[model samples]
Target: MSLAVTFAAIPYRRTGVVEMSDVGQVILCTLLLLAIAVAALVVLKRKGWLARWLGGSAILDQAPAIKRIAQTRLSRSTVVHLIEVTGRRMVVVESKSHIRMLPQDDMESHDPNL
Candidate 1:
């Protein structure tokens, strides 16, 4: 009787190097940094420092250019808005399809109460 020997090939796998808790810690740290960055931006924007740093106008500090004095809805799809900008008052007509500013002289002739 002859005895035969055979060797089986096995693949090596890496294990135990990284734990689940370590992965969880990394994710938590990333989320925390993101949240902190967002909070800082909110604080800067609310205090108007962000705009100044970016060399843009501080919208919160400036007076509004257009002010709505009055508005009247003529119909379901049409409305008239009396607006003022830089001391000049004008009537704006808005419909479903278009918006237009009425001429200054025409508005006086059309509406005596204006």
Candidate 2:
């Protein structure tokens, strides 16, 4: 019996190395830097370094109830009306200004007059 030897061709993949544009490289580098910065910030926050550095607690503390009450004591619309009627608004703004009336429904709950 005679054995025949056969040679099989192997396919090789050629990788094309493409050069990136200057702008694309800059953007990519910037994004990588930003990612690194964000990662560092997250690490600092996790270790409570950020809070200590800022002179605050790591956990978000609720604002004092009295402070909230004081902040929301007067509504913006109400204060605006008071200012307009009392003529303090013009003095405060330091100019002759025409007050544009906003629709009541458009006003935000936390809108400030001053």
Per-residue error (Å), model 2, residue 98: 44
* lDDT digits (tens) for residues 1-114 of candidate 1: 658877797867666667877999989999999999999999999998899888777675788999999999999999999999888889999999999997667777895765
* Candidate 2 deviation (Cα RMSD): 18.4
Model 2: per-residue Cα lDDT at residue 1: 75
Model 1 vs truth, CA RMSD: 7.2
Off by over 4 Å in 1: 1-21, 58-60, 109-114
lDDT of 2 at 7: 81
TM-score of each: 0.66, 0.33
* Residue runs of model 2 more than 4 Å from their true location after superposition: 1-20, 57-114
* lDDT per residue (tens digit) for residues 23-62 in model 2: 6887889999999999999999999889878978734564
- Which pairs clash inside model 2? none
